[model samples]
Target: MGWQIAAASAVVVVLAGLTTLALSPLLGRGRPEHGGGPDRDDEILRSTLLVAGVIGVAIAGVAGFLIARRAVAPLGEALARQRRFVADAGHELRTPLTVMHTRAQLIARRMEPQDPALPAMRQLLDDSRVLGEIVDELLASAVLTADPGRGEPIEVRALLDEIARSMAVLAQAREVQISVAGPPGVWVTGSRVALRRALAALVDNALGHTPPGGWVQLAVDVRGEHVVLAVTDSGEGLAGLDPAELTRRFARGPRAADGPGGRRFGLGLALVQEVASAHGGTLTLGPAPTGGARAELVLPIRS
Candidate 1:
């Protein structure tokens, strides 16, 4: 990233210098030189200015490039360290999560139906499985964005239905009803696993804010060449909140501090936005007409 910044600064500097050099003398091109008199001096001055401008532009460009690289070096290092940490953590946790999931299944087999802890255990199993999926996904795609064309075509509506079913457990625990409510036959082209994880993140975030007895909805809307997967919740609306700021990394809403310990501020929203961008799409957040928050993940429809 630092190198990229430096390179961009250098290119901008070069372009500016070239433009000045190419156009400066032309400003007085039609005028005649009177025996190397004042007009000639004007020409000389312009020439001098042109030369000096080039030299100054070159020096400034080099300086700017170096400064930009130095300023952004720490950020580059931080990003590298973060990627390494994610890769290492994903690799290390993959085995344990699989084992945990298998053990949960084993426990489920041994437990009686009437066991009071059955529900919690089942939730644990689901959580472990989802964690494993996330880890596997992180391992497969270590970057901030995903490769949308790496998989076959996906039946989007059916995928959303499955996601709703998977999230039903979480919604039930929260006493919030979650459902897929939209036209069917929606389709897209992307990795099923990646899309599934991103959509699940959207629904999970909605369920987190929705109060018990409230409802969460996943609806699809098609506009031109793009399709929108909108998740809305009947919790408190986004009063006095900036939708753009909330989508930024590490950003949080008003109720962020009051949420569960597992909540990572706006990390989920950030990832979803990244996914949307990768798939030639965008993410929008705003108030829902139903007096709640709405998040829209819009992607290009499969042609």
Candidate 2:
């Protein structure tokens, strides 16, 4: 009876060791079914461990994905809210501002030539017009952000010609000669209105900073798959700036408003950059070979 009991205990220890060896493969550090052992229970234990480990890894992966989604959602929502606010405010102010400007103009016209309030009223009207332009720019920017599909193809030469002609009087007032040069048949795909706005901004910047008899040149080139437009201004070049930063929102150069012949508002170049981006293009600022600042817009041609 004592020998049988000892034999039984030895068999139990051997079976336990075989089971642990089989499960080591499921722990990912060894081969399964080692040594040709014929233990059915060992096989069952190893299979169970393999399944549980796979399930644990799958759960961890899913949890990681959910955490990433939660982190990015808020940022996307915040951007959407910002664009919405700008669009709403711009739309709401348009009509009232138009009415106010008209009233101001009528009041100024009725005033006597020597009226004390005449100059102040005229200045107020001018300020109102500038504000209206700013609001319109904001609205256009917001719309472009919300819907990037609003752009269409436009003839390059015709558009530049129109902008140059429209600004002829302003250039004359500043005694700056505005000129345009480009291929007659060249074209670009973009929002005409947006392009017009961007070109107008460049021309205004040129006329504002250029001295009398200074020349501003508008040139366009179609090379390979790009439409390049350049606005060159003959004035004191940008000082103490990298030139690249001029495209950033509200970026001001060393010759900013504090210097002679600079615009009070710094949104002109920013708007140009935005327009370029909306049309899947790029805007760059550099020193013109003709001895002044140059703004370049390069748009990709549709394949």
Candidate 3:
């Protein structure tokens, strides 16, 4: 609305200036040539036009503001409702998911090694864990939209180690090697949970695109005032891909079609981008020197 009003005022002012220019000659012609004194008629005309232009611009600006507000009012309300719905739904799902995960774990523990249902029970537990993680991510994304929370001193190297360990099983299953490398005790200022999630998303994305026998590396470093955490994979690089489009929600790259799961919803990078923004940081995607994709999350160091 403010932008619209400013634009409208600019247009009105320009038009009024043109109109005054056009009438200047006419006003001057009406002044008596024989008078050596100041031209009262021209002076009155200039003052009147100046006042009229100001008044016209004021009126146009007000009207533009009202119109723009009315146009966007419904859209604003709809977005607010949508955010609330997502946050509420995510909250409601957490408890049930926790219970399901707990039950699956208990059932797995009770099952004998030779039991026919042991494998199925294990799969159920894994599925439940994955679902729980998804729920947490969803909830975080929704809540972060309204409140990004506070920042605190975080051990960047420790966080990277944690992420690498958490993803080790998955990487091993895929025949991919995952490693974390960086100097210890490096610190940054941000929400640890949010940063952890963002880094996890980046690693998960790298692992998904990487093929068997490939390697994924998570490297952290302090460059001046920013702490940089990057994930590089020795898989197919981002050749012929639109990096900007991939960052958009639900947007997928070309490899998405042939992905192991058959076309992903492409929410990982989007979530990473959102988390980066929430921390006043940035996420960058590019081709890694290892002939694969590289994702970098750069954040400010603790002051």
lDDT of 1 by residue, 1-303 (tens): 567656666766676667666666675575575465677767756775777577767776776767777888998888778768877999999988889899999999899999999999999998998898888767555543334465467788888899999899999999999888878887887657777878888788778877799999988888999888888989776766888887788887655546642233468778877777756778888889998888888888888
All-Cα superposition RMSD per candidate: 6.7, 12.2, 5.7
Ordered by TM-score, highest first, the candidates read: 3, 2, 1
Local lDDT at 59 for model 1: 71
- Per-residue lDDT, model 2, residue 46, is 68
Once fitted onto the true fold, the runs of candidate 3 whose alpha carbons sit more than 4 angstroms away are 1-43, 62-73, 150-154, 169-177, 186-197, 208-215, 223-226, 249-265, 278-280, 289-291, 300-303
Angstrom error at residue 42, model 1? 3.6
TM-scores across all candidates? 0.63, 0.64, 0.70
What are the per-residue Cα lDDT tens digits for candidate 2 across 73-105?
A: 999899899999998999999999999999999
Q: What ranges in model 2 sit over 4 Å off?
A: 1-66, 102-130, 152-156, 169-175, 184-194, 207-213, 234-240, 248-265, 300-303
Whichever of 2 and 3 has more TM-score, that candidate is 3
* Candidate 3 lDDT over residue span 1-303, tens digit each: 667666777777777777777776776677667654566655857775986687677778777777778988999899778878887887899899999999988888988999999998899988988787777766666565556454567899999999999999999999999999989988876666777878888888778778899999999988999889999999777766777878888887654546543223278788788788867789898888767888889987777
> Considering only N, C-alpha and C atoms within 3 Å, which residue pairs clash in candidate 2?
none
TM-score of decoy 3: 0.70
Q: What is the lDDT of residue 123 in candidate 1?
A: 98
